[model samples]
Target: MSSVKETVDVAAPLRIAYNQWTQFEEFPLFMEGVDEVRQLDDRHNHWTTSIGGVRREFDTEIVDQLPDDRITWRSVAGDTRQRGSVRFERIDETHTRVELTMDVEPTGIAEKGADALGVIDRRVKGDLSRFKDYLESRGHESGGWRGRIRPADPGSPL
Candidate 1:
């Protein structure tokens, strides 16, 4: 398995950032390889994504969630067996730091080699950078189910 974390500062407050992160449906706008994500139930989500040239689908279960701090999840039974979390840290009222950590197992020798070469890490970083841009953009969150997600907690959501 490989793990990585990338951080970026957002011009929004901790609450806004946290709120934005919980809206799974909006993930397709910034999440790497994600084609669609929908909350199936309170604790379950259905997702369709393309990764490594393969289109895959999965049902992810939210393991733990803490408002304004962190949210963690893992794939149920699918084309991928991966788990990860995105953490939020407040740098003040207007600057929130976001950190993402993912643990994944490559499927083959070539895939493993690519992962070891940091391709996955770079891809994740690019995704996060896009997320930051999406959040700070002019219009309200694009195509997000604003009322569907529940916040993490009052403190760290890691």
Candidate 2:
């Protein structure tokens, strides 16, 4: 598994930034290589992406979610095996720090090679940067889902 983490400070307020992040379908506008994202439900989404000429379709289940704070998900079924989280931190009334962390398992030789070469890391960083630009320019979120999904185990809290 290869882990990649990246952060970007957006000029938008924390609520605006966090709300924009919840609009999964709009990810393609800022996330490079992402072709489409369909929200199946409050806790599930279907994703289509082409990265490094490899196309993949995956379904992710949101294991935990908290409004205006963080979202965490893991691949439930599909061609991808990964888990990740995005955190929103309020830097100020009009600024937010967005952090993303992902752990992906390379399936084949090509993917392993790319991971070793830091391709995945660079892609994540670039994606976050684009997200910042997209949100800052828009000044508001397209849509938002403020629903909450607690962690799977009752004993654990997020």
Candidate 3:
């Protein structure tokens, strides 16, 4: 498994940053190689992405989530094997630090090569940079999901 962590300070409140992260459907706007994201439900999401010329599709389940704090998920069913979490920390009233930590198991030559070459890291960095710009420019989240999801009841949203 290859691990990558990236962080960026956005000029937005903690809620604004956290809310925008919850908007999974809008990920393609800032995430590179992500073609589409569909919120299957409050705790499930379907994703289509092409990375390093390899096209892949996956379904991820939100294992744990706390509004304005963090969200963690893992690929439950798909050709992809990955898990990650995003956390938000308030630096001040107008600044929030967004952090992303991901663990990915690359399958096939293309994916492995990209990971070994740090392509994934660069991509993640670029994604975070874009996210910072996107949220700062908007100055607000497009929408938010304040409900929490606990590991004990993964599908039952709270």
Q: What's the lDDT of the predicted structure labeled candidate 2?
A: 0.93
Give candidate 1's whole-model lDDT. Answer: 0.81
- Arranged by TM-score, best first: 2, 3, 1
User: lDDT (CA) for every model shown?
Assistant: 0.81, 0.93, 0.93
Which sections of candidate 3 miss by over 4 Å? 153-158
| Cα RMSD to the true fold for all candidates | 5.0, 2.0, 2.8
lDDT of 3 at 60: 97
Tens-digit lDDT track of model 3 for 1-158:
99999999999999889999999999999999999999999999999999767799999999899999999999999999999999999999999999999999999988898899999889989999999999999978999999989787556652
Which 10 successive residues of model 2 have the least lDDT summed?
149-158
TM-score of 3: 0.95
> Which residue pairs show backbone clashes in model 2?
none
- Candidate 2 to truth, TM: 0.96
11-86, model 2: which lDDT tens digit per residue?
9899899999999999999999999999998999999999889999999999989999999999999999999999
Task: Give lDDT: candidate 3, residue 109.
Answer: 88
lDDT of 1 by residue, 4-76 (tens): 8889888888878888888888889888889999888877899998877778788888877777788888888
